[model samples]
Target: MRTIAEIKESIEADFMRNETAAKLYGFTSGDSFAAFFGKLSVESVLFYLFAVAAWTLENMFESFRSEVNASIDKMKPHRPKWYRDMVLAYMKDRTLIPDTDEYDTADMTDEEITAARVVKHAVADESDDASLLTIKVAGEQGGRRCPLDAQTESQLKAYIAEIKDAGVRTALVNIAPDRFNCELDIYFDPMLLASAVESTCREAIQNYIENLPFNGEYTNMALVDQLQKIDGVRIPELRSATTVAAGESVVTAIDARCVPAAGYFEMGDVKLNMKVYNG
Candidate 1:
C-alpha cells in the first residue's frame, strides 16, 4: 500500500509535468489557474489530494467498524433504543468536522447537514443559558491606511452620533484600532448592534451602511418596516465586530450569522485572540 506521502509525490509528479508544459507553452501567471490549469495553486491541489486520502481512510475505518458491529449485533437480540442513540452520538463527536475550504465555500454537504441536526440537539443539552454581548466599534483608524476614505476620528464620531439616532445605544461604545487593519473596533453593551439599527435607521442610514464591508449575516429588519418610507430593503452582513470589557482588551466574534430558524447558532463564532493568544 502506498503511504500518503508516496501517493502525494506521485500526484505532484503529474502536476509538475502539466505545469511545466503550460509554462513552456506561454500560460501566463495571471491566467485562470483552476480553468486553464487544474488546481487553484500547488497548495490547493495538495490540500484536495489530502482530503481524498482522509476520506478514503475514514471509509476503510468504517468498514472495519461494521465488521465489529456485525459481531456485536448478532449477540444482542433486543438492543434498546437508548443503546442505538448512544452509538450514534459517539460517532458524531468522533467524526472530524469536514474541511470547508478544500471542498466547498459553504463547507457543508448533504450528510453533514443531516448530521448537524443531531449534533445541534446534543450540544443544546450542554449549554448554560448565556445572553449575547455586543461591542460597538468605530470604522476608522489613525495609523493604518483605512479601507474606507472616511476614517478620521471626526468621521467616526459623527457616524456614532447618527448610529445612536438610528436606535443603537452608543453611549459607552468602546472603540480601538486593530493593529493590522488600523480600523476602530466597536462592541455594543449588547451584541445586536446591526439588528437594533435596522429598526431605527429605516431611511437615512440604510444606503450608506449597506455598502460597509460587514461580517454579520444581515437581513432587513422590517418583518414589516413600520414606516412606508423604509420599505423593501435589506442590510448586508456587518463584518469586523469587536467586544471589550471596561479597561480590558477587545475580543471580536468571527461569524455573527445567526439564522433565527437554525437554533444552532444563537450568537456568532468568536475568537478571543487573533494575535497574542492565537500565538
Candidate 2:
C-alpha cells in the first residue's frame, strides 16, 4: 500500500497541482476548519478577515486555472468555437490541461482492468449511517463523563428530524471522549483550545459513525458542563456542497459529496463553535 505521504501526493497530482490550487486547498486549512470558517458571520470585522483570506486565495487559484485553460485552447488547432468551448470543459475536468504532456493515456486492456478491480476491493472496507451528533458538555469538574439526558436527547432528535427532509438519513452516534480541560482556563482566551478540541472530536465522532456497520454499531451520546451550552456545541462544515440533480447531460451535475457540519457548545465563560466540510 502507498504510504500516507504517497496517498496525499497521489491526490494532489490527480488534481494537477498548480500553486494556486495547492493554496486553495492548503494543508493549514484542513477540511474540517474550511467547513466551519465559511458559516461564520463575515459581517463581523474579525471573521471578515478570514473571509477575505479565503476568498483572495480562492480567486487566485481560479484566475490561474482560467489562464492555463485559455492558453491550452489557443495553442491547439480545432474548430473555430471548439477552443473556446473546450477551455471551460478542461477547467472543470482536472485530468487534462495545456501543461500536461504525459496526460496521454492508452486504452485499457483486460489485464489493466483486472488489476484495477483488485485494487478497489483491497481497500473497500467502509460504512453507511445517515446523521451523527457528538455532543460534549462542559462540567464544573473535568473527568471524561456524561450520559444521555432526556432534554439533550430530544433536542438532537429534533435536529436530526429536520435534516431528514433533505433525503439524508441521520443516526446519532454518541462517543464520550476525554472531557473538556477545565484547568486550561477557557475564559483566558475565548476558549480557542476548547473550540479546537471540539472541532476535532466532532470530526472523529462523525467519521466513526460513517464507518460503522448498520446492524447495531452505535448508541446516542451525551455529556455535561464541558460545553455548558443548552443547545450543545455546533460546527458546520459546508454550505450547499451538493448540486441538485437535473437529469441532463449538458447540465453536468456534479457527483461529489458535500458534507457541511457545525458543532456548538459553551464552557467556563467561553463558547466553542466550529464547522467541517469540503465542497
Candidate 3:
C-alpha cells in the first residue's frame, strides 16, 4: 500500500509534468505544489483532497488483494501443515453447527471456545500412504508439553474426523513425552562447590531439553555446548545419550541428532559426574 506521503508526492509529480495545469494553477515548473501554494490556499486544499482520495484507493486495492489470497487458500487442498493447524484449533466439548464447520458462537462465547482449545503444540506429517497423515499434538501443563486428558483427546479426534477432507485419513498422536537419558562429565573450577555446580548443571540440562521446539532435533553436541555455557565449568563431555519413545521399551542411542517420536521430550536419568579442575 502506498503511504499518504507517497500518494501526495505522485500527485505533485503529475501536476508538475502537465505544463497546462501548472500554467493555470500559477505553479512554476521547478516548484512543487507545497512550495508554490500556501498551506491554507485553495490549490493546497484541493491537492490534499486528491491525496486523500488516492490513499483511500490504495487501501481498497490492498483489501481486494487480501480477499483474493484468502479465496485461493480456501480452494487449495488440505496439506500436512493445514492439518496441524486444524488439530491445534480443536475446541473440547464443542459441537459444530449443522451444515457448517464452525461452532455455534451465539450459544457459546468466543472466549469460552478459546479456553477450551487444549492443544498447544502440534506437527503433521505424511505417513507411508500419501493419503494418510499422522498428526502429533500436546497441551501445555505445568509449563511443559503433555498429552491431553482422555475426554479431551476423544473430542479432538471427533473434531478431526468431522473437518478432515474426504478420502484423507488422519492419525492422531497424543502420548507422553519421549524419555531422554544422558550422562555428562563436568570439569568445574575449585572455587565453586561441586554439589552446587552439579545442581545448576542438572537444571540447565532440563531446561534445554524441555525448551527444544516440538518435533525438533536433539543433538549430543548441542547438549555439550549448552553445558559448557555454565559458570565454573572448564570442559563438558557427553558420555552417553539415549532415548526411548513414549510407550516403547527399546532404547536408541543418539549418535549425533535425533528427533523425538513423541512431539516433545522429558528428562529421564541424567547423571552428572563432576570433577574439580586445578588448571
Candidate 4:
C-alpha cells in the first residue's frame, strides 16, 4: 500500500502540469508554488490533491486485498475427502433446494454420512474395487419428515455433481428413519394453562429432543432446562426418558447422555403430564 507521504509527493509533482492548465494559472513551473505557508490558494490546492491521492490509494489497496482473499477461498481444495465445507455450502444453496430452508447438516463419519436433519450412509463393500459414496436426506416433505424422494434427491444430486470434480462420482442412498420413544412427566404452573403453556411445554421438549443432531449426545439436564424456558412452565422436570434401542430399554438418567447410532431422533410417545408446583 502507498503511504500518505508518497501519494502527496506524487500529486504535488503532477498537479496541473498540462500546457493549458499551467498557462491559465500564469505558472511557468510548479517550483514557483513550492512554499505552501505563504500562498493560501496553493496550500489549499495541494492539500486537496493529497487528500484525493490518499483516498484513491486506500481504495486500491482495499480492492486488492478483497480480490486476493476471494482468490484464496476459491483455491481451497474440494477433493472427495475434503467434503464437509463444500457439501455444506452446496446443501445451503437456494438454487439446489428451492422448496425448503429449514434443513441443516451435522455429523459425518469416515464410512457413513451423518447429519442432524437428514442423511444416510450406504454400506460399503471392502471386497469391491469401486467405491460407493451415498447420501440420503430426509426433511420436511409435505409437512412431514420423509426421505428426499427420487425427484428432490435427483435435483440435489445434479447440483452436487456440478460442484464435484470430473472424475468423482456420488450415489444417493435411501435413508431409514430412527425412532425413539420418550415419556415425559413434567411439572408446571396451572395458572399458565389458560395460555396453553402446558401444551406448549410438551411440544417444545418434544421438538428439542426430536431435532437433536444425528448421533449427537442427548443430556437429560439440557431437556429439563429447555422445557422450563416455555412461558407457562415455572419448574420443568424430565421425570423419565427411556428409549428402546437394539431391543433394549435404555433409560437416560438425570446425569446421563445417549446418542442414536444413525439418523435423527424421532418422537415416539412424548407423554407430558404437567403439575402445578412452584419451588
**Which structure among the candidates has the greatest TM-score?**
3
Whole-model lDDT for model 3 versus the true structure?
0.86
- Single out the weakest 10-residue window by summed lDDT for candidate 4: 118-127
Q: Per-candidate RMSD vs. true structure?
A: 23.9, 28.3, 2.7, 12.3
Per-model TM-score on C-alpha atoms: 0.17, 0.17, 0.88, 0.48
The C-alpha local distance difference test score for the whole of candidate 4 amounts to 0.55
Angstrom error at residue 153, model 1: 85
- What is candidate 3's lDDT per residue for 1-279, written digit by digit as tens? 788778877877787878898788777675767677678887667877999998998899999999998889777777889888878777777788786567666766777877888899999999775967889999997877899989888888888888888788888989999999999889999999999999989999999888899999988888888888999989998889999998899999998999898888999999999898879
Off by over 4 Å in 2: 1-141, 173-279
Q: Indicate the residue-level lDDT of 248 in model 1.
A: 42
- Please report how far candidate 1 places residue 96 from its true position, in Å: 39
Number of the top lDDT candidate: 3
Residue 95 local lDDT, model 2: 36
Return the lDDT, model 3, position 7: 80
Give the whole-model CA lDDT for all candidates, comma-separated. 0.34, 0.32, 0.86, 0.55
State the displacement of the C-alpha of residue 144, model 4, in Å, after optimal TM-score superposition: 7.3
- Candidate 2 clashes: the total is 33
